[model samples]
Target: MKRNIAVVWGGYSSEIVVSAKSMAGICSFLDEEKYNIYKIRITKEKWTVEVGGYVYTVDKNDFSYICPISDQRIYFDFAYIIIHGTPGEDGRLQGYFDMLGIPYSTCGMMASALTMNKFICNNFLKNFGIRVADSLYLNKDTKYNLRGIEEKLKFPLFVKPNTGGSSFATTKVKAVDQLQQAIDAAFGETPDVIIESFISGREVTCGCYKTKDKEVVFPITEVVTPNEFFDYEAKYEGQVEEITPARISGEMTDEIQRLTRKVYDLVGAKGLIRVDFIISDNQPFLLEVNTVPGMTQTSFIPQQIAAAGLDIKEVLTEIIENEFNAI
Candidate 1:
């Protein structure tokens, strides 16, 4: 019997467009013969499932959809989560799926929550002796010591939303004068933000995933952006050149892969994830882990996957099989 697979996309986050694109790519590659796929679009306004040019409202009680024409109810056997932020990336959706006993792609609840918070995740990695940028955390209501931040971190720092990704509301301040405005912008995105001392180095990222049979790491990619940093435009637009097999040495690649696997295990990450890093003074500093990495043609994960001599069909199959076996 063919299993029903729901590719859940869209969330109450700025990355909804990216999530929608990710699901579109994923849906195309999943072997249609083996599984019946449906695109479940979720938003703050509504969660609906489209089938045969008709849309049906999702029954949140059981995550099922009833066809209006036939009045038939359909339930998914598995869920492929692609929502990039909030509710999805932050573990709320995972928790809901857990209660419904539906296996979804990506990490479990606790792991998702831990990794969504930048300050907490970076500090957590420090326990394993992983190098990360020095940062300060600020709440929306607190009085931040701007002078202290300037004194300790110096100029050329970053202000970013504490829990958001895609560099949404992220600002790079090269001088003290730009600090306040950046903070306000970051706070506008989220109530909490992290201010970090800039780590000057080559920006590279490694994609990895662990399955029941084995663990796999894709080739590292070097990010060279024409902008000030790998911000929103650089990531989604033509403002960046992402070089795969990252013009680095064998030693560097091995080290990065080792760290990648180690962090994957440390965070108990499942499915595919991309870990960003900055190599300075010949030492790699952990930037962030994307549990739900992008799947678009221009995204880094797809580039890394292709560079590894593997296609998305095989890669996603392995991940889905692993999740199926676990359930």
Candidate 2:
């Protein structure tokens, strides 16, 4: 029997549009003979599935799509979460699915919760000898010591939402005067903000995933942005150059890939994860880990997948089959 696959996309954050595009790209390659694909658009307004221009509401309790014509409750056998932020990426949806005994295609509740917080994950990796930049953690209501923060971390700082992705509200502060405005802007996205000292170096990212058999690491991609950094514009727009199998030395590539796997194991992440790094003075600094990385025309995962001499269909199939067979 062909298993029903629910491609859960959209979210309660700015990354929802990107998530929709990702779902479309992945769905385009999904083999229809072996599996039945259902596009579940999740948002603050409604949880629905549209078929042939007809919208059917999904039963949140049992995770079933209600058929408008016959009123049949179609339950999904597997859920492929492509949402990049909030409920999908931050563990809320994962936890809900957990309660229903439904398996998903991303990290579990705890791992998602831990990794979505940049301060916690980076500091945790720091303990494992993975170097991360010195940063100040701040909450919306917490009193921030600006003088103390400035004294500890030098100028040319990066202020970003600790729990947000796609560089939604991230800012690069070149001077001390621009700190407050950046913090305020970051707070608009999430409740917490991380202010880290800038590390000038070659920006590169490597993606890794695991199966029941072994872990798979893709070739590293070098990110050369004409902007201030690899911000939203550089990532989604055509403001940056992403070179796969980066121009870095073989030794550095091996080290970052090793570190990337270690971080994945450390966070207990499932599915594919992209780890960003900054190699400054020949030392690789861990920037951040993307649990649900992009899959659009300009995304790095597809580029890395091709550079590694692998097919997107097989790679995505391996991911889906691994989860489906387990159940």
Candidate 3:
């Protein structure tokens, strides 16, 4: 029997366009014979499902995907959420799906919510012996004091939104004068922000997945962006070069993979995830873990999957199957 799989994308996030692109990639790669795929677009006002190459707009109040032929409603057997940020990655939509009793690919509500906040997530992992960069959390309600920051951390610090992705509001400030401006920009994007000591090191990431009884980690990917940092343009505009199986020592590679799996288990994550890190002073520091990673043509997960000599579609199918059987 062919199960109905709903590939959900496009949410109220700054990464909405990126999410749509990822949804396209996922729909194209999903197996056609084993499952009946439905491309569902989640907008602010309505939820529409594409079936038989035609789009049918459904009410957002009701969770049913209306069948045009039978005039009956069909619920999704499983949902593959490709939305990258905001409601999708921040556990809002995941909680809604949980209430609906639907199985979706990705971590549960708590893990997703915790990992979405960079400050809280990194601090939580520190108890498990994870090395994160030295950072100070601040919010709009807090007092702005540059002298304290200057005393605690050196120049060339990174200012970023604590809850956003795609490097949307990330800036590197070299001097004290630029600190306030950077914070303003970051705060414009999110209420909470963090300022961290910038480390001059190679940026690398690793992808991981878990099945019913086993976990598999993919090769590390080294990211080289043309800009000062891996910001929005570098991430989405092809202003960067990504190398799979990062050109690093064998020992470093093994250590990163080990840390990746450890953090995955630490956060109690399931399905697919991408762990970002930086190698500084011959040591790896945990940056963040993405629960809903992008699946675009240039996305890191697909590249790593290709490097591992595995079909992307097959891997996604296995992930969905695992989610189905886990229930």
TM-score for each of the candidates: 0.98, 0.97, 0.96
lDDT of 3 by residue, 60-142 (tens): 55466677799988877888999887788889988988988889998999999999999999999999999998999999788
Q: After superposition, how far is residue 313 of candidate 1 from its true place, in Å?
A: 0.6
273, model 2: CA deviation in Å?
0.9
Candidate 1 segments exceeding 4 Å error: none
lDDT of 1 by residue, 28-144 (tens): 878888899999999989999999887889999999988877788989999999999898888999999999999998899999999999999999999999999999999967787
Candidate 3 Cα lDDT to native: 0.89
- Positional deviation of residue 150's Cα in model 2 after best superposition, in angstroms: 1.2
Report lDDT per candidate: 0.91, 0.90, 0.89
CA lDDT of 221 in candidate 3?
99
Worst 10 residues of 1 by lDDT: 139-148
- Per-residue C-alpha lDDT of model 2 across residues 1-327, encoded as one tens digit per residue: 998889999999888978988998878767788889999999999999877788788888799976767877799988889999899988899999999989888999999988899999999989989999999899967897777778899888899999999989999997778889999999999999999999999999999999998789999999998898988888877899989989999999999999999999999999988999999999999999889888875689989999999988888889989987777
TM-score of 3: 0.96
The C-alpha RMSD in Å for every predicted model, in order, reads 1.0, 1.1, 1.5
Which portions of model 3 show Cα errors greater than 4 Å?
52-54, 59-62
Error of 3 at 133 (Å): 0.8
